[model samples]
Target: MSIQLNHTIVAARDKETSAKFLSGVLGVPVGPRFGPFVPVEMSNGVTLDFIDTGGEPITAQHYAFLVSENEFDAIFGRIREAGMAYYADPHHAQPQQINHRDGGRGVYFDDPNGHNLEILTRPYGSGPP
Candidate 1:
């Protein structure tokens, strides 16, 4: 059996605001609310569940997205137009810009929840210089 990721629970001070922020960045719609959760679904059928924490301290999480070259260009363009800082590597080896590592491009940024979000046009070994 193939082991696939299920879903991740993101802590949010306000579910609606967090969901809206993510929806704007990911270019997806925030679905209906259920209990304390507001979910955003990706094109791949994965769901990101935003849970209201009511002022509780929530640790930051990192999320990575594997996208196509065209998608990366569009998303990175949006990120730049929004003045968001982005990077190529997870360790943040490079800063304030995009990286064409293994033949593809990648960028990283933070979400409203302080989650490290990344967009990569290719896999790890596929990055370019």
Candidate 2:
């Protein structure tokens, strides 16, 4: 069988909260708990499994999602509706804006657990410069 990513573990202070937060922002439903994970299946069939960190200091990680143009608009609307801070760049130097990278709209924001989250309409290097 071809190698594929089925799932990934995401550390969070509370798995349920993190999973719900992600699913809500992406406009997807949270899947049933499997073992210790609260799964959020992506459109690509890969799942982000959220697990609780038990209050330890959590190291943040960056997670990126490639979305359709319409999905980008809806997700961005939810982001702003929540009064969240977003940036055009991952480094966050450009705030309150989105980037036209790869000739498509993109933005960066942080989850409740401080993990860097990104949504882009085009894959890097997949479109005109």
The top-ranked prediction according to TM-score is: 2
TM-score of each: 0.86, 0.96
lDDT of 2 by residue, 6-106 (tens): 99999999999999999999999899999999999998899999999998989999999999999999999999999999999999999999999889999
Total residue pair clashes for candidate 1: 8
Please give, for residues 2-112, the per-residue lDDT of candidate 1 as tens digits: 887766788888888988887887677998887778999888878889998888887988888888877777777778888887776677778887877778777889887
Query: What does the lDDT read for residue 46 in candidate 1?
Result: 82
Model 1 spans > 4 angstroms off: 1-3, 126-129
In candidate 2, the residue pairs with backbone N, CA or C atoms under 3 Å apart (3 or more residues apart, or in different chains) clash, namely none
Native-vs-model 1 lDDT? 0.81
